[model samples]
Target: MLGIGIVLSIFGLGFFCWLLFTLAVYALPFLAGLTAGLAALQSGAGVIGGLVVGFFAGGATLALGQMAFATTRKPVIRIIIGLLYAVPATVAGYQVSFALAGIGMSSGGWQTAFAVIGAVLSGCTAFSRMTLLVPPPDGQGTGGAYSLADERLHDQRH
Candidate 1:
């Protein structure tokens, strides 16, 4: 029973971490809102006030980040924005990696190495998640289409 419990706990932790990595972009806003709401509540704000503040704070942050990314055309500016999104994820990943490696803060080099690896992995994951995939051109129909003739006919009707 003890062994089973330990196994289950480990599995749960792993699953949670997987979700975090996979959904970091979406998760970030909720985390920001929760943090802000708790802070507000602790500061003597009423429950309703806290909820409103949290909702706006989270939504604004997400919307602003997206808008900045969408509106910017310069490569350097876009890269900077991407880095902004990635840095927090990298920090979180480093913390998780450090904890999992069982390396004390005093362990210096090993800890640094693991943290770097974690940061790289998490940064890439975050960047990939944030990127929008463009749809294929209409001219390139799915293989299910019988031929270009069918595609041309369908296109003409529309």
Candidate 2:
């Protein structure tokens, strides 16, 4: 039983880490949702009402960010949008890493160092994920049949 418990603990930790990484990109939306939820709860909304409000708030935050990222053409504007997503992820990563590290490490210095590293990696991951919605560089074939037709013509020409 003891051995089984150890195995299960390790498995749980691994799963937790994976979940952290997978949801890193949603940090901003999560932040928004959490804030809205708390506000609603404090403002006399019932539990179910707060939850519904929070869900919509988070969804709108993500949708707006993606749309802004996809529609903006300027590199500077895109970088700003990317930073908005990354900054929150980095903060969350640091807090999580510190908490996780406290489970195994004792030294304060080491824990902070580890947390900072995790924060940087999380920020980079968030930025990369947001970049997926970037607009085409040349503004051509951004959507519709044009981009498809352009690709076919390029293939035939070469």
Query: By lDDT, who's the top model here?
Result: 2
Each prediction's whole-model lDDT (CA): 0.73, 0.88
Candidate 2 is scored at a TM of 0.80
| Residue lDDT tens for model 1, 55-90 | 988898778777777676575886777777777777
Error of 2 at 59 (Å): 0.5
| Tens-digit per-residue lDDT, 1-158, candidate 2 | 99999899889878866777778889999889989988999999989989998999999999999999989878899899999999999998888888887887899999999899888888888889999887556634546468788889999999
In candidate 2, position 124 carries an lDDT of 87
Error of 1 at 135 (Å): 8.1
Clashing pairs in 2: none
The list of candidate 1 runs beyond 4 A from truth reads 1-10, 26-39, 103-112, 133-158
Worst 10 residues of 2 by lDDT: 135-144
Per-prediction RMSD in angstroms? 5.9, 4.4
> How many clashing pairs in candidate 1?
0
